[model samples]
Target: MLSSKIIMTPKVKISYILNIIIVLVSFTFGFRYIFASAPLNYQLEAIGVHGWNDIIPEYRNMITTFVRVAGVGMTTASIGMSIVLFRAFRYGQNWARWGFAGIFLAHYIPLMCNMFFLKTTTESNPPMIPNLIAISIVLLSLFFSSNLKNCKAIENK
Candidate 1:
């Protein structure tokens, strides 16, 4: 129920390029912040932060594992998203929208939870870059996905 909209017009191409630009800007900052927080500590293990680990030793390991896993996910999703955006910038497409949505869905894993569970509001914590990116991605995806829907009805037999 989807197809590329590249042949539409030059206007559409420009629009898609603009959208991809926004997506790339958001994704870059989001990925950077996410990886910084959950840096890969392959050299050491279980360097749990204080005021939380005493009650749950398992929590430390769980968190460490989760961080590593999340990092992998984010990296993969980021690469996929970049591909979609690059395609959109070059060729334009309905798939770009759904592809962006997939990125948002992938981002919601650790990205959303971290914002929800670790929001300190103390001015010391980094801003919610991933959260904002996630929101933008979803919004953009739904917008373009709707356009694809209309095209699908006409294009499909």
Candidate 2:
């Protein structure tokens, strides 16, 4: 019989925890956007901010639709990726470690850049710090983990 045991190193444990965080956060945001988009859009329009009225109605609707679709797609992808990462980590798949690392970085880098570089309003400011810190911790934990090193070695064999 094939052994289906997962070795739990400190790094692997940390990675698992971070993955869970990622899933939870993604799901939270995903559901929030999916359910609240209409109201949120209306609220933005009411505030007369974020150039809500500057754009033509047709273009505005297109943008809103795009954002909603993207939000749902991202949420689904994140959940699927979380499951895949969990299985990969359990089976000691080196590629999954790298994949997760890459995906995490890709997903958050733009947000971080926008948070720091672009001028954010009161509405946007609240989530910036918490999100940055959380993402930083996850990235650091994943990169610094010894599990990645072991996985790399395994990949070479």
User: Scored by CA lDDT, what does every candidate get?
Assistant: 0.52, 0.62
lDDT of 1 by residue, 74-117 (tens): 56666777777665523445666677666757666556555544
Candidate 2 contains a number of clashing pairs equal to: 0
Q: Can you tell me which runs of candidate 2 are displaced by over 4 Å?
A: 1-3, 39-60, 120-126, 148-157
Question: What is the lDDT, from 0 to 100, of the residue 116 in candidate 2?
Answer: 56
Question: What lDDT is obtained when candidate 1 is compared to the true structure?
Answer: 0.52
| Candidate 1 off by > 4 Å | 1-15, 30-72, 88-93, 120-126, 148-157
Q: Estimate, for each residue in 55-88, the C-alpha lDDT of model 2 and write its tens digit.
A: 6788667767866775786587586668667666
TM-scores of the candidates are 0.48, 0.67
TM-score of 1: 0.48
Best by TM-score: 2
Name every residue pair that clashes in candidate 2.
none
RMSD of 2: 5.6
